[model samples]
Target chain A: MKRWIPVVLVYIALIAWLLFSVFPFSTTLLIALKPKNAFMKFPPDYFSMKLTFENFKIVLSDKNWIKYYTDTIIIATLSAALSVLVGSLAAYSFARYEFRSKEFLMVFILALQMIPAASVIIPIYSMFATMNLLDTFLILILVDSVSSIPLIIWLMRGYFSTIPKELEEAAFIDGCSGMKAFWAVTFPLAAPGIAASAIYAFVRAFNDYIMARTLAGDRVVTYTVGLTMFTNQYEGVDLTLVSAAAFTALIPILIMFAIFHKHFIIGLTGGALKD
Target chain B: MKKRKWIPILLIVPALALLIFVMMFPLGWAFVTGLKSMTLLDLMTGGGRFTGLKNYFKIFRDRLFYNSLRNSLIFVSISVIGQVFFGFLIALALKNKFVRFKSFFRGIFLLPWIASSVIVGYSWIYILDANLGFLPTLASVSPFLQMLGLNRKDWLTNPSIVIYVMSVINIWKGMPFSMLMQSAGLQSIPDTLYEAARVDGAGAWQRLTKITIPLMTPFILINLIMTTMITFNVYDVILVMTSGGPNHASEVLSLYVYNTGFTMGELGYASALSIILLLVNLLVTILYFMILRYRERRLA
Candidate 1:
């Protein structure tokens, strides 16, 4: 009975806490769905207010909205794929083979994760402009890929380290060349890890604002870049319209996270927490 | 089967090339640019006058830079503490098997972590707006808020408490992540240790303080490093929320850099300030690793 009391108390507290945590997300949805009139009313009735998708309709109807989503999608997909392709092989190399300056190289790469894009925006902009690479899909993709590689490398390295050495030994004993053995056996086994890395890369690239703001232009703007233009108006911020745009921009990543929820946990934890 | 000498180097080159082009080269260029007077036009023209360390001297003397640095340290410290405290509680609560729908709860908690900062900024702004804000709505309904005079309070606009408000929002945004990390750490603790403590007449509080805290130190270190860095570098929230206004009350280092570079058009000065930001981050990373290595040595 005493133990049951503690458990019940904990549960109640947790329920309240969880509600508090998710209230903002709920606010986003509610505000996003409300028409402009509801927003204008003094002391806006957040709940039981009439809901409408007029905001979404307006946002979706914009010509740049389609460009925004497609550009973001293209950059995100390439960044994830390129990071996985480049990062995993590096991970395998770090896990399996050791060479000169390996320690130095690993440290250098990890330190790169701490360098914010804003810190180097001046130079990157100059260089990109020099090559006519600014506002291009390739520039955005390359930036995203470069930024994502360090974390993905660490994650894939952790995953590679966990796979038992004996599996690779078995393949080697079966007369498989090193590359063949990796491609045929180890690669298949690392699919979950690859998925996790890809998801992380996708999320990281998708959420980037600094890179997009600096490097992107009128034609190459990502959704997040476009979302900020809502508040940049001369008169005042249109909260309802901005909320809708923000929520609309959030939908794809939310769906991605929902579909790969378990992998997100595994990937994130595996990267940082795995022994 | 063959451990080729060149294989590892080959694997590293392609990633290295892209990384150098996008990250390393630009950082190096930033250092050079910081030594000169640069403008938007000078971006491609290489026309900035070479004025060695003049930008660094000016930025160091700027009052806005000082306020931003001070604000960043204060905000980051509060954020790390608040998030970790709440996160530990949430992780402990969720780890209990008696909690039903654990996975559902986990997914819900991930919302703040995975959502774009731009959206989060907007969502918070919608809720915290002084006129039609959720708080004021509660205030209009509940006498408790009126007692404290929180009715229609300008949370983002009030410069004095604005830092605290920003800290709270960032703490909420970062809590789910530390919760996730702490949950992983809590699960990895073997049940036998707790059972042994129980056999020794340890209370729940005693067991947590004596056993759990000691073992959870490593994950807590990781949490500290991550939350500190992210909180320090937070830009978009302040960018959207208050634009670091009514004055420069809420401006952190990252936002200050953007304002100085773009809004004020002082790229060289911004570069110098960011170099300091990088130095601070490097110090923190070094500090975390040193503590970890010390712990390892002690254990051995």
Candidate 2:
């Protein structure tokens, strides 16, 4: 009985948490299917009468959404790729090299992570405006890639450090150059870490709004910014339209998680645990 | 081996170059901008004169600056505390041996962390809308409470309650990260310690107090620091829900800096405010590291 009591409590607590976390999403889903008038009903219509595709149809038909989705995908993919490429090299360096200021550089990179983008958004905006790079996908990709470099470097460094030095030494002795040896031997071993970092970089770039809003303005709006338009116009707060948009925005992430669930979990937990 | 020494440096150059261009350059530019007299036109056109410390002085004189700082501190403290405590409790409960379906529960609990902040803000807005919301429904269900004359309040619009509402939303969004961290920490603790305490006839409460809390200190501290830093820097939710309106009651330091620079066109003064925020974050990070080092030494 004593042992079972704690078990029951834990189950109860978990159920409560699940309800809290999932209720809003389910509510949004329900509201999306409801008729326009059903949104504000006092008794709260749990189910929709004559399920309508109007909200989804309207959201999909919007001209700007295609551009927004395209821009988001482009930025997220390019940033993730760039972050992984640069971060892998830097991580390899940190793993193998015994240089002066190595620890300092690593800590400096960590400190850089602490600097909020909001604190620097103005300066970045001004800089981009001068350079005429505002509203360019290049700016979004560049900012996200740099912001994600530290974690990628750290995670890759952790993964690379665990690989035996003997493998690299053997490859070098067998006539492979240092770079070639790393590419052939160490890179494959660290693929999981690289994959993890890529997902993170992609997600960060995909989900980021502050930087996107500041840098791109309306010209290169991401899906997040596109979603914001639903609210800013404020025509009686179309719950159904907003819900459909929210769900649309969430689908890609959910799909990514589904496809790369193992890598995502490994990457996130691995990075946190190592820290 | 000798040739290989520079290879790492060569490999690291791209990342370093990108960082310097994106992060370091803007950081230096911000400081320089803060030291200059720059209008929005001047900033946009790259034609501004240096006027040292004047913006800093003006920022100090601004009443909104101090109010933002105070509100930020209060919001961060309360939200961080709530998140960490609840997260720890939930983690502890989940870590118990008898807990069933742990992975399913954890995944569900983690939904908030992954959900977009904009969506969470919007959902809460729907939930708290005074005219038509679930809370009003719940309130109406209890006639005794309705008879007690409790008026429904528009939580987001009220200045006094806006900060608290924001804090609740922040906590809801943030607690999952802390929960994951605490659960990970719990995994590292050895089961034998708990078993030995049980064998000693120690009650369940004693076993938990003696074995669990001390072991979880590092994770708790880490979560505290991270959450505090994050809460202080929060913006997306505030921007979505309130936009620092109703007399700017929910204006945090970061948001204040944003509004000053972008909305009001006070570029120089905004830069000063940004610097102040940087200093505060630096202080918090230093304090955390100091405590961590002290604890490490004592443990060693």
Candidate 3:
């Protein structure tokens, strides 16, 4: 009972923290599930309000929303694939080579991770505009891939460095060429890292509002951008529709995070702070 | 071995070139474009003339730019403090051996982090609204709160507290990442160190301050730097939540640049502003690399 005291205290604290953490999510979810006409009341009046799934139904029913959803899925998938492909190629070179200017290159790539998308959005838009690529899905994809690559490559390098050189050495001895040895032996070993980075890239791209809205605009509205349409035409925000649409935009990534929190957390910390 | 020197170069060149084309080229172009007078209409036709430091001078003279830079600094400082403090507490609590279902708690705590900034801003708009909102509703019911003036938080509208409110929101959103980082740091501290401290008759507070904290400095530094950078560049939440309204009370540098470039059609001026921000980011990154180098040397 004496030892149990501290454990019980820990549980109490944990529960209190969790309630605070869960408040926004639960309230938002409650609002989303509420009937369209039901106004938010003090005490929340859950029993009195007519609860319904109509908001979610409305969100899904619109073809515009479907296009937004499809656009996000396409962009996220392709960008994740691109980040992994580009990241792995560079990461492998960094891991395997003892080349000149390696340290300089490493630092340069790592520094690229901190370039906030806002800073580059102007030039990126201008460059793409010059090529008549603005508002296209391709531009969003390119921007997303570039933004995701720096971190992915760094994480991939960390993963590659962990696998012993002897595996590739053994492959080489078995008559495999350098590229073949890497593909046959080393690449498969880095699959978890690849998956983690891909998920990270996907989440970043999917959740993006600034880049998606700025570059793609009305031509390729992502879910994040589409959901913004719920705003008041004049005041520029509508809580009722926003609650529904925000909930819709949130589910896929939330589910993904719930399932892969371990990989996500590890990959994030490993790539960032670990030397 | 000498012949294979170019092999690595070949392998990396495509990726490096792609990155430069997509990432660095835009930055360089933005810098060059900053020297020119460009707008949305002239974007494709190349109609803007070279104006040297005219755009830069204009941004420097702008009051909004100064306010934004100041706001960014304040927001970053406030957020860095709040996130680090709350995050360290959460991490310490979670690190307790008595704490059960650690991962479950971690997942719950990460709700703010997992949600997109837009979703976060959207949710907060309702939560902090003067009417039909949580805080105001709570204030209405609580007599003590009403007596103490503890309720009715004007989270988005009030210029005085808007930036602080934004800081708190980011602190909540950013705390989870720092918590995880702190946990990693805690785990890396060998148990033997704690056992030795215990043998020497150290109390819980002493152990925390003397052993746990000192050992966790690197992680703490990382968290501080990362959260600072992230908070400084906050645009989406502010854009969606307040649009930097209430007389531009909460406009950060990113929002200023974004509005200027995208909305105001002052691309050249926006580029100059962003370039300033970019230089800040680069300077900080260099400092971080130096710190990392020093830490590595000490550890080795």
Show where candidate 2 strays beyond 4 Å: A40-50, B137-151
**Candidate 2, pairs of clashing residues:** none
lDDT of 1 by residue, B163-192 (tens): 888999888888888988898789799999
Q: Give per-model CA RMSD.
A: 2.4, 2.4, 2.8
lDDT of 2: 0.81
Scored against the true structure, residue A195 in model 2 reaches a CA lDDT of 88
Task: Report the C-alpha lDDT of model 3 over B45-149, residue by residue, as the tens digit.
Answer: 788889999988987799999999888888889889888887888888888886779889988898888788788887887678776566677677789978987
* Best candidate (score: TM-score): 2
* Per-model tally of clashing residue pairs: 0, 0, 1
Q: Candidate 1 or 2, higher DockQ? A: 1
- lDDT per residue for candidate 1 within A145-252, as digits (tens), equals 887788778888877888887898899889998888898888988888899889888887888877888878577888888877655741244567777778888788
